[model samples]
Target: MSQDLQYWKQLKEKNDASAIKYFYDQYIKLLYKYGYHFCQDATLVEDCVQDLFLRLWEKRSSLGDTDNVKLYLMVSLKRSIYEKLKKNSKTTVTEEVPEDTFDVTFTMEEQIISSETDQITKDKLLECLETLSGRQKEVIYLRFYNGFTPEEVSEIMQISNQSVRNVQASALKKMRNNMDDPLLILVVGKLIESFFHEI
Candidate 1:
């Protein structure tokens, strides 16, 4: 293990609150960024990040050996988002929003065009996600959006670790095969490309 991993392990072993806080401070922004990509709502992403860190801290005693803390955070965020989505689906939106409480702004033609393009790209990605089998979609979401190791995912999903890896590999292959729409593929490709660049 690298020095950082060794440091984290020692801190983890000690169950130090400062170490946990340090970990959260270090990775929260990255987690929020990834969460925003999955949720597309700033407030929702903020809530998810806070909840994820809270859970991580609470479960720190039982946390497994993780060489990559960032990956662990990512996986936690992914699972949280999925749970949020599922819960929201089952809940009724009965809360009323006052018209005056909302701000409506007019956009310039260029801004409007850009907004439309972004929506189009997001729609295409959602469509691609929908094309996946339920299990495949779950695995892909956990792997890419959450950054979970296959073993972690398997433990959570109650499947074999190899099965998690297989599902992820198969999902990516199928997504690539189904990328017949050049524009959509280009958009998705750019998004994935940007992720690597940021890393």
Candidate 2:
């Protein structure tokens, strides 16, 4: 077993505070980023993340084993955020969160994009990204940015495996058709390399 899995098992079986803290220390930043995508409220996102860990610790005795702790955490966090949103909506003071809130805004580091392309190409890439639907953007983010497999994304998004593949395919095709330059396509593929930075 990998070290992460071992730590997770320790956390589950022995209620190891150090093991749980190790996970929190490693993933809190990424979790915050992912949670922020679901709800732009930074404070709300932070609360949900803390609540997730607290609930995990309380329920650790009955938790199942997992080979992919990061994926599991992300799936749990997404659900937690949505549940919180739903609860908030039921209250008197209403807040509107659009169904398609998986917005993707690109922030290219000078070293990453400038060395290869000028401003025009960068602009074209951003335009191409804008063409994708929120679902498509979410699929792309989960697939490339987070390096999740299609099956994994299906689990995270609560969609069918084929739907994940279809959305990903259509999103890529849309971007390819929108952009004339091949370099833009290359950049899109390299989105895993901090192209989708923490919000």
* Best model per lDDT: 2
What lDDT tens digits, residue by residue, belong to model 2 across residues 84-129? 8877776443554455777767555554355566677777767777
Q: Which residue segments of model 2 deviate by more than 4 Å?
A: 91-99, 109-119, 180-199
Query: For every model shown, what is its TM-score relative to the native structure?
Result: 0.47, 0.81
Clashing pairs in 2: none
Query: Each prediction's Cα lDDT score?
Result: 0.62, 0.78
Q: After superposition, how far is residue 157 of candidate 1 from its true place, in Å?
A: 13
lDDT of 1 by residue, 42-91 (tens): 78778888887677667767878877766667667766776676566655
